[model samples]
Target: MSPDLSLIFVLGLRMAVAAAFVVSASIIAERSGPVIGALVATLPISAGPSYVFLALDHDAAFIAEGALASLPVNAATLFLALTYVLLAQRHGLLLSLVSALAVWFLLAAGLRALDLSLVGGLIANVVAFAICVPLMQRYGHVKMPLITRRWYDIPFRASLVAVLVAAVVTLSGRVGPAITGILALFPVVFTSLMLILHPRIGGPATAAVIANGGWGLMGFGVAIAVLHVAALRFGSAVGLSLALATCVGWNLALWWNGRRKVAVAK
Candidate 1:
């Protein structure tokens, strides 16, 4: 293959892989209850693929530094969830999303500016969860409503994930690790959910889904923290593997606990 053709082929392959992964997650999210949806939403569907590509291009040290950048940013996502949930209570989709995004950017900027050490990253997540979790407890349990699936939902989510994957893969070399890590966790899936759900079921119901997402996202914070340590001690490949495992393990524990509760109740 020619250089141009190879580049196109690679980009297409990345898009296909990312789209397939994310669409599956979105399908489960759409079919399952809100808690399940939240768990699916928290999976590394976006960041995982991006980090995989980044690992191919960068070294373990680079991956470790990127995780450091990612830590506070990961914490920032919870605030984005919280901001949207609160604003969505009385606001329309545009205002709520735009406002929530604005809050995310502001908080992300502040957190990133902290010149965070690993401990600082942990503290950021600790503080964010401390503030957001109890509040989310009140809002997270709203029942998932059955709604007709729109024809555009699949394409919309697939496109969103594709664009994000493409951007991260193509730009990782150009932007350096810090920016790459920041871009990797840009909440593309959540944005897709907001676009689809906020209109279908209205704000509060959607907020329930987003609110429950906070728990899963907290696991992501742990994953990044693991990445920071493991990448430096091991290699990027091992680090990424361990980090992904941490996230998967945490979510699995939550799911099992949830199931156990259901069985006990029944």
Candidate 2:
């Protein structure tokens, strides 16, 4: 196939993967309640596929560096989530979402301009999430009933994710690798979740869900770092496998503990 055609084909495939994963996870989240939904959102469904494509287009070394960069980028996303969580309390969905995206863009840009390494990025993510989680819990306690259905909800969500994935892929090369990696990991899934759930379940519940997902992202940060090292030592396929395993294990443990605590509290 010609390079142009191949690029189109690959971009289509990436969009398909991203859309399907986000929609499926969103459906499950709606049925399963907020915490489980949050856990599902943290699975790297969108970012994982993007990383695969990056590795395919470039090589293991490129993927490794991107993954390393991805760790620090988590802080930016956490900031985004927190922004939404806080704003959603006193504002409408559109206002909260717009503010959150602006914050994400600024933080991502600033972080990309800095000279950060794996250890530094990891530390930044850890601190950001650690500080934000408690504040999120404090602010995100308002609750509401499950929302009425809308005919456009699923289609709107699927299309939004697809567009975001395409935009990130198209823009990745224009920016440097660090910024590319950060943009690639943009909170597409999280955005979809909040957009759908906020109107339906109300802002408080939606914010709580995103906050929970933000805490869960620590696992994702660690997994990306591991993927970087493992991909360098081994290869993309093996490295991704190990990284997914590590992330899944961490997520499951967190879910179990969270569930157990909920049960005990009840």
Candidate 3:
């Protein structure tokens, strides 16, 4: 295939993969409970594919640095979730989303200016997520309301994910690898899910989902930190594989831990 054809093919593939995950997660959120839905949404479904393409386009070192960049940005994502939850209580959905996105931009800018190392980035993410989760938890644990599925829901979510993926990835290339990595975690899936749920279920229900998603992001943070270090020592593929394994393991541990806590409560 020609280079142009290959680029188009790759872009299509990326969009398709991202869209599938977003749609599937939203569906699961509709069918299952918030915790399960949040778990699936937090799995780096969007970011993972972008990172893979980053590796393919750039070198292992670039991807490694990008992975490090991704860690602190997880905090920005947490902030977005928190802001949305807080604002959604009093404001309309669109206004709340706008306010939250504004906060995200401000926070991301401030964070990018700090020039943190991998360890510092990891610490920042840990602190941010820790603070965000419990604060948002009050909005969680509500009973999920039963809502009829809209016929256009899946298509709309897929389209949103596709657009977000395309825009983020395209801009990442222009911005350089470090910023690219950070931009890669733009909360596409979380935003889509919340937007859909906020109107259908209510602000509180959507907030619950977003809060759990923020908690789940802790595992994602660990995975990216590991990938940054590992990719430098190992190759891209190996590092990514290990990182994914770590993410899955951490998420499973969180699930089991949550279950144990619930059992104790019972």
Best by TM-score: 1
**Candidate 1 segments exceeding 4 Å error:** none
Question: CA shift at 89, candidate 3, in angstroms?
Answer: 2.4
Candidate 2: tens digits of C-alpha lDDT, residues 1-266: 99999989989988888888888988887777667878888898888877776667677877788787777788888889889999988888999999999998888778777868888888888888887777787764445366676899888888987887787678766765566678678888888887888877778888877877866788888888899899999998888998899889988999889879999999
- TM-score (C-alpha) between model 3 and the true structure: 0.93
Task: Kindly list the per-residue Cα lDDT of model 3 for residues 94-163, writing each as its tens digit.
Answer: 9989888888888888888887898899889888977898888888776789988888888888888788
Alpha-carbon deviation at 20 in model 3, angstroms: 0.9
Candidate 2 backbone collisions, by pair: none
Candidates in order have lDDT scores of: 0.88, 0.82, 0.83
TM-score of 2: 0.91
Error of 2 at 147 (Å): 3.3
Q: Candidate 3, clashing residue pairs?
A: none
For model 2, the run of ten residues with the poorest summed lDDT: 139-148
Answer with 1 or 2, whichever has the higher TM-score: 1
Question: How well does each candidate superpose onto the true structure, as a TM-score?
Answer: 0.96, 0.91, 0.93
Q: What is the lDDT for 228 in model 3? A: 89
Q: What is the lDDT of candidate 1?
A: 0.88
